[model samples]
Target: MALDKHSDTFSLQRRNQNGSTAPLTNWGFRNETDPLTDVLLGSPAHLFHRATSSLSRKHLREAPCNIQVAQAQHAELVSTYKHFNVNVHMLEPEPELTMQVYSRDSSVMTPYGAFITAMSQWWRRGENYAAIRAYEKLGIPIYDMVTAGTFEGGDFNVIEEGCVLIGCGDARTNEPGARQVAGWFEAEGWEVRLAFIDEYYVHIDLMVVPIAEKLTAVCLACTEPGIVEWLEAKGHEIIDVPFPQTMALGCNLMSLGNDKVIAPTSSTYLIDQLRARGFEVAAVETAEISKTGGGIHCMAQALRRGD
Candidate 1:
């Protein structure tokens, strides 16, 4: 299929043409908290790796991930996605990159198409090419590629239709790359907010997450006060997740939209808080897998999210 020049954005639907369902030509997403229709998950076949990030390195030095246990945990994550009726797509394995299981860092999904990322770590850079191959195989459009500086998809969060919050710690995503992303979104009429987080936190998703239309979970101890105030001013109810749990990836829960969320079972505090708010929660155990430095949100990339 060719690019639809007349259409403003690519469609994710497999349209029924004539008597058969036509192949998908494009896939896109606008926000994080939407009914997840399609997602990209990483394979466990190549997930065995030593600690790369500062956070994971500490624990990895003490005790590295048990490959078998990590693989089982990963399968549970995939099963959870399937149980929710989400269309799961896997990236082809890159044997040399063990941290590739955190597929969220490979690329950012936008309403226009995919923004292929530039990984900061040398060993993990190959994941970008794998993401490109996945997009091509799925027939998704490539909106842009970050060549200015290092940028990872985990730092790009679509908070609303016309608003995005990006994090730059100079490690995962640098100022140059963040500026480039901001410019692209601004040109498309989006109000982009830049959050400069501590490098230890890795990505903004680790500090702040949107779970519903006007509800967000934030790690108050680490998040900037201005960002919290801004979110509150926008009518977003902030749920403060404890610092200890935040370190455990508590704030990294995935929103399935319509007041539904998928979280890690180890994050009891977040699970209880989400439940108290009457949101449906699907909690999966990621104790073994998370030792590699990410949570459920980092493991899956949304391809299509419903408004």
Candidate 2:
């Protein structure tokens, strides 16, 4: 359906004039009432990373010259997306670029639309605008702009049905960013809590992710007692990620509806834990992708949730 000229709320699926549902797959509608219904998260490979960086003097490290490895990882990522029956959109890299774009800011989804964030890293700053243009080109609405607050989409997490947990730290996202999102969620009558983790934690999703309704994946190493208590208060069952596995991004698994997860093949323990929970798990090797310090959850964001 066509969207209003001035509004960002547009439909990617065709609409039925006679009050019937559109034919854009059973789970493809962007439901305004259920904001999580049509949102999606993705990582751009355009920028990988450097071992260390400082605004003053930044060190640059090029991804392995082996195009084969990059292609292989992309292929794996594409298959993962297809496995979940979602669309996969890749961003082409511009020449003379530094750093890889594995963590393309954060993936922000709202009832009105999806707003991809700008990269906090100076070299990757342009990425946010690029993501915005892409969503606009695809007819996705912009819920809000994170201009004053530099936030990455990775830190945003929905712990319970209506409550969201956002992290503020590191160079990626800060207090201003958390407050920015808090304002937006508050405007919608949703509950948001700001969790202050050390900079080593990066994004909230890095340490915590919801694998299924009432089920959460967390790195026992990075999770705080208070956070655990909070999750318990919300009646969420925790699937712990062992320290080694967590470092390998084992906790970064993504949920595919009920009792199923998309995880990295390298993370044996995490996959086993998921299976123990009766989840049908799919494991793909993400060595190259994980080099940038994120796994399935970091590489992808869920835009839709099924009831």
Candidate 3:
């Protein structure tokens, strides 16, 4: 069954001191594993596009996607979200923007609001505007916009309410942008962990994902040793996803609260690991979509995490 276009049912309402409804400043996400009540899934209308970066070229191998199959895969994702009782919203498609389907790269959701990213790739820069429009439509306030340097939302992962891990590598999220965002978190008394990864890894999310409270999936081979150690020391259960599977985006899974997750079908190892650890796994075949340079986590951006 086709999912209906996103309704206003998920719109948040909060009362100000004056007894009038106002948008909450802390409306977005504080933790990735909280009850995922709302999310923004990117549109797949222009998914088939020319490769803009090495990651895209490597994953796509310069091959074209089967548009029909890609759309079908995306629908499965939406269906899974609905089945899990998650409110799904779609980014209004921009026919001219080919890479707009990866909504996670355009902006990041924070406890305060959404921070729009400064896209590194010229071809993907237009996606920021599309994301801003979508957020406005959803009544999600814009917390801040990145202006210091290039940054993508894929590099951010919230560990808990007061702790976050940000990836900093010149290839995607440069130091300036990472520092700017870090400052905001620090001012709020949050501990910000910086993971400096190799350029080969497009984002930290490609190597790390929080599956549940005190549990995380990590590509140990690629993720920095210090970062892994810090997580372990923080009492997180480390589920190590091997290099081969990680390269296929096995670590790029989304936590849908209640110990459930949505992952790519091809991520057999990670899916099995998650299930073995008692997580409900909702798998979708994203072969065609992944070829466009991202996996499930990279395709959807969390909007509201809790009730």
Candidate 4:
């Protein structure tokens, strides 16, 4: 798949005409736990507090998010990424896209290319189009777009190089959408597992996220036993994050590879565990912005990792 950087003639679907799609030479990554070289982030300048989920709704009922504080927290997060020597790319902010701060929900970066997701919320649907524009500006070719049904990028969990654990939360990512994505990877000869979760969880990353090559952080209290067993069968060391912390988006963290991670400060359990293990953890405060619905990982989209 050759991407024309000088013009807007890049292919919309970069997947091979044949079953095996070749990985992009200059972009994309084989796995999540690779030294991150580039990341895509959205500006919190237009961020607004809305009832995007049960958690956000509760926060709104209790105390709405402080917009100024949220923007400052986002700046701190950007600084953390810069401190780690990772290149950060920001999406053009649109005033109407209040939830655009969560960049991970618009599209997913994979070895093949960017997979544009279908936004479940009416207000967020513009994000899909915005994602395409962002990719174009970055000179990244899109592998494909989800059309079977609604599927957000948060539900697309790439567990390893070729294996993926897709989440199907009826409200956000429906069964049809999950299977559609599963079928694409199946054709590419990758292992695909579908985990059906409750709507309240919003996304799979809320309860399960990969920490390293063979380490995963999971909320055992909420994750299904079968999923846990499957991970264990694959020799993955599970670090069980407590239920309360998980609800606070403790498990939703970004693995920068090379034993480094970016996590939310409120997730003390996960931060402590990572620190004890000698992992260089950049704990950024996200409590204010998270009230608008998303954490650290939700705010980023890995563009390139490990050459």
Q: Indicate which candidate wins on TM-score.
A: 4
Runs in model 2 deviating more than 4 A are 1-48, 52-67, 96-106
Task: Tell me the TM-score of each prediction against the true structure.
Answer: 0.92, 0.79, 0.89, 0.96
CA RMSD (A), model 4:
2.3
Using lDDT as the measure, which candidate wins? Answer: 4
Query: Per-residue CA lDDT of candidate 3, range 1-307, in tens?
Result: 6321122222222211122222244457668998899899888887765565566677557576678888998888889999999889889898778888888999887766677899998888999988888888887766668889999999888887779999987788999999987876676677999888877788989999999999999988988888988999999999898898888778889899888899988889889988888888998888787777788999989988874
Candidate 3, residue 226: how far the Cα is off, in Å: 0.4
lDDT, each prediction: 0.83, 0.61, 0.81, 0.90
As for TM-score, the candidate ahead, 1 or 4, is 4
Name every residue pair that clashes in candidate 3. Answer: none
Any runs in candidate 3 off by more than 4 Å, and if so which? 1-26
Q: Look at candidate 4 and give me any clashing residue pairs.
A: none
lDDT of 4 by residue, 1-307 (tens): 6554323234688765445877777888888899999999999988989999999999999999999999999999999999999999999999989999999999999877898999999999999899999998887888889999999989988888899999999899999898988898998899999999999999999998999999999999999999999999999999999999899888989999999999988889888988999999999888999999888889999999993
Residues 1-307, candidate 1, lDDT per residue (tens digit)? 9645324343332222222322223466667887999999888787765666787897788878888998998898888888989999999886787888899998887776777889998888999888888887887766778879999988998777779999999988999999988887776667999999989999999989888888888999999999999999999998899998888898998998888899988788889988988989998888778888898889889998876
**On a 0 to 100 scale, what is the lDDT of residue 206 in model 3?**
92
Cα error of candidate 3 at position 113, Å = 0.9
Q: How good is model 2 by TM-score?
A: 0.79
In model 2, where is the ten-residue run with the lowest total lDDT?
A: 28-37
Report the Cα lDDT for residue 202, model 4.
96
